[model samples]
Target: MSDRRAIPPHSPPSPCVNICVMHKTRDLCVGCFRSLDEIASWGSMAPAAQREIIDQLPARRQSLKRR
Candidate 1:
């Protein structure tokens, strides 16, 4: 039998639900709550970095609600 263990996937599935609308003043996609920069960089970011952004998403959304 082969010795190699199955590796977990590196990228977390995207949060995008195809809503795609960027809130004009906040500059974040309303569906995924990612800033334009975050959205642009997501494809290239390391998995750990991507997780950090994901962790921040809820707070970002909350801030939007307060505005």
Candidate 2:
């Protein structure tokens, strides 16, 4: 087996469900909740970067909930 355990698997498809809208102020998506730049570059970014962004989502949602 390879020694690449630190990397995550390929990104999963967007669960868009046709609800494509971005958060105007934060440049995040109200639907998928990813930042616009993140969404745009999703296909090319490496798994580590993707995981870093994915890791922020829950906190973002919590911030939104507080507002």
Candidate 3:
């Protein structure tokens, strides 16, 4: 059997792609574009709060790509 389990419908999905490297200049994760504090507190954040962070990811990714 697979070790993976389904996430509950109400929970916000994590953005982690397992690449945990931190960008030296940007202070964000190069893989998921989340800051260190965001990553650290993600589990405890409310669904709405999580969604707020997720909403910002696309813009962050775009900014990184422009560099």
Candidate 4:
């Protein structure tokens, strides 16, 4: 007998805008504002964690503007 359980859907889509460039001073992607580690591990993160990251994006963008 095969054990079947419904797997939760993936977290919300990545914020990648396809610009794909890491800011030199900030070490964050200019398009998505995610750090290298965040980008790499996004696929495995839980929905809540991903949402947290998403929520922080606007602030990150604003900070970048100040740089």
Best candidate per TM-score, number? 4
lDDT, each prediction: 0.89, 0.73, 0.91, 0.95
In candidate 3, what are the lDDT values of residues 16-43, reduced to their tens digit?
Answer: 9999998888999989999999999999
Please give, for residues 1-67, the per-residue lDDT of candidate 1 as tens digits.
Answer: 8899988669998778898999999899999999888888889988888899899989988988898
lDDT of 2 by residue, 1-67 (tens): 8776665577756534466787667777777678777888988988778778778878887776676
Using TM-score as the measure, name the better of candidate 1 and candidate 4: 4
lDDT of 4 at 65: 99
Q: Provide the clashing-pair count of each candidate structure.
A: 0, 0, 0, 0
Give the TM-score of each candidate: 0.79, 0.69, 0.82, 0.84
Task: Write one digit per residue (lDDT tens) for candidate 4, span 1-67.
Answer: 9999999866898999999999999999999999999999998899989999999999999999998
* TM-score of model 4 (CA atoms): 0.84
Query: 1 or 2, which is superior by lDDT?
Result: 1
Error of 2 at 51 (Å): 0.8
| Model 3 weakest lDDT span, ten residues long | 4-13
* Model 2 pairs in collision: none
lDDT of 2 at 11: 73
- Cα error of candidate 2 at position 50, Å: 0.6
In model 4, what are the clashing residue pairs, if there are any? none
Measured by lDDT, the strongest candidate is: 4
